[model samples]
Target chain A: MKAKIYVTLKPGVLDPQGKAVAHSLHDLGFDDVADVRQGKYLEVELTTPDKKKARADLEEMCKKLLANTVIEDYRIEIE
Target chain B: MKSAVIVYPGSNCDRDMQVALRKITGSEPLMVWHGDSDFDKVDLIAIPGGFAYGDYLRSGAIAARSPVMREVVRRANQGVFVLGVCNGFQIVAEAGLLPGALMRNRDLKFLCKDVHLRVENAKTAFTSHYAGGQVIRVPVAHFDGNYFASDDELKALEDNGQVVFRYCTGDGELTGEANVNGSMHSIAGIINKPGNVLGMMPHPERLIEDILGGRDGRALFKSLLKTFPLAA
Candidate 1:
């Protein structure tokens, strides 16, 4: 099974890197851009075929090591 | 006092901290590697600054999970004095030794300069040598030093007087320019709830010698030595 996790900064937390990217886009004539919040996308391949177990394991991985729960939220999808 | 300085793979400031403590206490500190499991009855444990684990995923994230930190945490909970500086601060926060997390600077830059800080509380073991509200200059060099905590956590820290230092202008007034990293409430350093652990982004060890610029940071070591009289 293949899994993907998206990690994003929590709401109300400042994302300087995302803001800088948004500013750079505006400076480069991309005026249509409203906002951008940078996030991390992780792709993992698991040997387990059980979707339920894979999801649970991925969430645990995200909480334990992949993401900082204080300011980050993560979602996992298995395929 | 017998002390130990934890040395991670990428730690570059362990020697500087060791030298400062040696000069003040007149004792060579143990340089403990990250793989060490025992602290060996040390009076103090210091986590020095550097890009530990190359700061690959996050600053200090990898180093916080190292074997030495497990023992450091264990000892710290038993009332051991643990000091974390710069990247060391990040490691402590990540390991839950201190409140709040250090994120990238507000300006998204690697700030490296001499910054002034006001001593908010001098009753702790780390700042007893300095008077409260006294402004001291310390050099800071880091890309991610902006401290963040929940509103309730901030209020609790303030209520308990855990805020030990805050960025301030030379005249001791808080201002945006004084806050190089845009830390919450302009916080520069803080102690844990129990007050035995302290984490700060500034490099006090780098400023302990007069040749480096100022010896203002010497007070921290002096104060710490006073806490453990036997170490002197």
Candidate 2:
């Protein structure tokens, strides 16, 4: 089984990298881009065959290391 | 006081930290490797600034989960004093020892220079030597030294007197221009709930002697071992 995780900075948190990218986009004439936020996309291969088990394991990974819950939120999709 | 410095694979400041500890306490600090989980107990443990694990996944994410950090967390829970500097600050925060996180600088640049810090709480084990409101110069070097916390956590940190130092002007006034890295409340250092742990973005170990251009950082280390005060 494989799980996909998207870890993104909390909405209210400051995103300097995202802001810089947005500025660059504006400089390149993409003024329509209102805002930009940065995040991480991770794919994990789990040995578990059970979808429930894969979700649980992926959740643990996010809580323990994949995402810093203090400032970032994570989403997990198992298949 | 017996002290130990945790040396991760990419920890470049371990030697400087060891030197600072030994210079202040007059006793050599143990150099504990990141892999080893066991070592002699010490009065203080320091996680020095450096690109641990090449700062992959996040500045301190990898090293914070290393074998030694697990033990460091256990020892910290046992009331052992822990001082985390720069990347160390990120590690301790990532390890769940401290609240909040250090993120990219507001300008999205790697900052490396001296900045003024005002002692906000002088009662901690790390800042006892500094009088409240006193300003000192310390160097900060990191890309992700900007501190971030949830609204509730920020309130708790402020209400609990956890904020130990704040970026300020030379005259000790807090202002927007003085905030080196967009840290919430311009916080430069903070003590944990137990007050036994401290995490700061400044490099106190780098300025322990006059020859280093300034000795303002000496007080931080001196506060840990009061027997020896940096000569006035």
Candidate 3:
């Protein structure tokens, strides 16, 4: 099984990189792009066939290492 | 003031800290490797600055979970004094030794320069040699030194007087421009609740000698020596 993880700076936390990219987009004439919040995409391979176990393990990974919960939020999707 | 400096892979400031610790504590500090967790306990543990693990996932993320940090967390819980600087600060925070997370600089740059820090809480074991409100010049060199904490957590840290240093003007005035990294409350350093651990972005070791630009950082080492004096 494989899991897809998305990690992002929590709302209200300043995302300077995102802001800089957004500024570039504005200069490029993407007026509709009001803002951008950048994040990380991770793909993990798991030996467990159990979807439930993969989800649980991913949650633990996110909490313990994948993300610093103080400023980031993570979402996991198993495939 | 027996002390040890944890040496993580890619840690460039380990020797600087070792020199500072040796000079002030009057004893050579053990350079314990990151994989070693069996080193004997000492009066103080110092974490130096550098791009640990090439900062692959996050700054200090991989290194924080290394074997030695496990020992660091264990020893810190028992009230052993710990000091972390720059990347060291990020490691300790990532390891949960201190509250708050250090994010990238607001300008998204690696800042390397001397900044003035106001001593917000001289009562901490790490700041005892400095007077309250004293502004000291210390160099900070990091990409992720902007401090962030939840509002409630920030309130608790402030209420408990854990904020030991704040970026401020040379004349001791707290201003937005003085906070080069955009840290919350202009915090340059903070102590954990038990007051046994301190994490700061500024490099006190880099400024410990006069030939190195200034000796503003020497007082901090002296402060630790005062806190844990050797038996007579």
Candidate 4:
């Protein structure tokens, strides 16, 4: 099984890097872009064949280490 | 005062902290490795600044879960005086020792310069040597020092008087222009509700000596010595 995780800063938290990227896009003539928020994407190869176990384990990882719940929210996709 | 400086991998400020502790308290502080589980008998524990664990998962994220931090969290809850500066502050917050999360600077830059800090709460053990509303010059060097907290949490921290320091102008005026990293409420440092744990972005150890441009940070260490005497 493989797990994919998306970690993003929570809404209302200032995303400076994203803002900078947005500015660069504008400089490149992408002026229609309103905003941009940067995030992390992780792909993990799990040995477990059980999707249920992988989902549960990924949730644990997200809460404990993969994300700082204080400022980030994470979503997990298992295949 | 008997102090212990936790040395994490890539910690650059542990030596500075040790030097400051030895000079201010006239006692050599114990150097505890990140893997060590025991803290022994110590009056103060300091987590110095650095890019711990290469700041992989997050700044101070992996280091906060290291073996030694488990003991740190336990001791901190038991009224032990714990101080975290710069990356250390990020570690403590990641470990849930303080409120709010330190995000990247508003301008996305690593700020390294002297900023004036106003003493907001001098009643705490860390700031008792300074008078309330006193402005001190200290240097801050970090990329992620923008403090952010929910509205209710911010209100609670304010109501409980946990905000110990706020960035301000030299004359002690809290203006938006004085906020270097865009920290919420211009907070440069804050203490826990019990006032035993303090986490701040500025490096007090860097400014403790007169030859180091300023001695504004010496009073902080002196204040701790007064509260936690070596004899005790």
Candidate 5:
């Protein structure tokens, strides 16, 4: 099975990288952009094809290692 | 005093911390690898600064879950003295030993220079050497050093006096930029609920000797040696 995890800074959390990107985009003449928040997209390949097990394992990975639950949220999609 | 310094793969300040410990305690500190399961019967454990694991994913994220941190957490729960500096502070916060997370600097720049910090609460094991409101000059070098915590957490910290340091101007007044990384409530350092474990973004190890700059950081080590009880 293959999985894709999207990790993002939660709302109200400051995202300096995202703010810098927004500023650069504005300087480049893209004035319509209101805000930009950057996030991580991780693609993982797993040996098991079971979605249930994969979801559980991915949740554990996010909680224990991947995502910092204090400031970030993660969503996983298994295929 | 017997102290141990946890060395991670990318830790660059382990030797500096060891030297500081040795200078004050009159004994060499044990260099424990990140894979070590045992703490080697030490009174103090220091997680020094540097881009641990190259600051991949997030600052201090990978290093927080290393094998040694598991042991560190266990010992910390037992009331052992633990100090985390800069990246080490981020690791401790990520490990949930302390609350909040360090985000990138608000200016989005890697700040590297000496800054003034006020000793907000000098009652903890880490800052007992200084008087409350005393200002000390320490160098902060980091990209992601902004500390964030919720309102309730901030209220709790203030109520319990867990806040230890706050950024200040040269004259000892809190200023906007002096809060270097935009830490909430201007918090530069804080202790855990138990007050034994301390995490701060400033590197006291770098300022222990006068040759580096000033000796303001020396008193911290001296105070630690004075207050720490010998193992029974």
Candidate 6:
């Protein structure tokens, strides 16, 4: 099985890279782009066959290593 | 003093940390690899600044989970003195040895220059040599040096006098313009509740000699000797 993890900075956390991208987009004529918050997308291969078990395992992974709960939040999608 | 400098795969400042430790204590510090789990019962352990493990995942995220860091966490909890600088600060915070997470600079720029730091708490094993409210110049070089913590945690740090340094002007005034990386409360360095472990973004090891343009950082290293005279 494969799991897709989306890691994003928590709300109120500063995203400097995202801000830089937003500035560049505005410079390139994308004025309507109000904001751009950058995040991480990770794909992991797991040997588990049970989707429920994989999700639980991935959540633990996110808590332990994938995401820093102090500044980031992560969502796991198992496929 | 028997000191150790933890060396991760891409740790660039381990040698500098070693040099600093050796210069101050007249003994070379042990270079412990990331894979190592034992601390060898050293008096001090330093996690120097650098791009450990190519800073993958996040700045210090992967290195925080390295085997050596697990040992570091255990030893730190046991009251062993730990000094984390720059990337080291990120690693310690990620390892849960300290509060707050280091994020990218608010301006999205890699900062590398000397900044002024005011000693807020001179009671730690790291800053006992610095007089209270003394301003010292130290260079900060990193992409992710902005410090962030929850409001409650910030209050707790303040209430417990855990803040050790604050970014300020050369004249020792803390102002918005003086904060280079947008750290919370302009915090440049902090110690754990017990004050045994310290994490700071500025590279004190880089300014230990007058040849390096200043010797303001030497007092920090000397403070270890003051804290533990036996280690001297």
lDDT of each: 0.92, 0.91, 0.93, 0.93, 0.89, 0.92
At residue B156, what lDDT does model 6 achieve?
98
Better of 3 and 5 by DockQ: 3
TM-score per candidate: 0.97, 0.96, 0.99, 0.98, 0.97, 0.97
Q: B1-232 in candidate 5: lDDT tens per residue? A: 7889999989999998999999987878999999887758878899999999999989999898888998998999998889999999999999989999899888888999998999988887777789889999999989988999988889998999998988999889988878988889888899998887899998889998779998888878887887764432
iRMS of every model, one decimal? 0.7, 0.6, 0.5, 0.8, 0.9, 0.8
Give lDDT tens digits, candidate 6, residues A1-79.
9999999999988888998999999999999999999999999999978998888889899999999999999988877
Give lDDT for model 3. 0.93
Taking the tens digit of each residue's C-alpha lDDT, what string does model 3 give over B26-127? 888999999999998798999999988888789999999999999999999998899999999999999999998999998899999999999999998899
Sorted by DockQ (best first), the order is 3, 2, 6, 4, 5, 1
lDDT digits (tens) for residues B53-84 of candidate 4 = 89887899999999999899999999889999
Off by over 4 Å in 3: none
Which consecutive 10 residues in model 3 chain B have the weakest lDDT in total? B223-232
How many collisions per candidate?
1, 0, 0, 0, 0, 0
Q: List, residue by residue over B1-232, the lDDT tens digit for candidate 6.
A: 6889999988998998998988986777899989988758888899999999999998999999998999999999898889999999999999999999999887778999999999999887888889999999999999998999999999999999999999999999999889999899999999999888999999999999989899999999899877766545
Q: After superposition on all CA atoms, how large is the RMSD of candidate 3?
A: 0.8
lDDT score, residue B66, model 5?
88
Give me candidate 5's interface root-mean-square deviation.
Answer: 0.9
Give every collision pair in model 5. none
Q: Tens-digit lDDT track for model 2 on B1-232?
A: 8889999988989998999998877789999999998999888899999999999989999999999999999999999999999999999999999999999988888999999999999988788889988999999999998999888998999999999989999999999889989998898999999899999999999999999889998889889987333331
DockQ of 6: 0.88
True contacts kept of 1: 0.41
lDDT, residue B165, model 3? 94
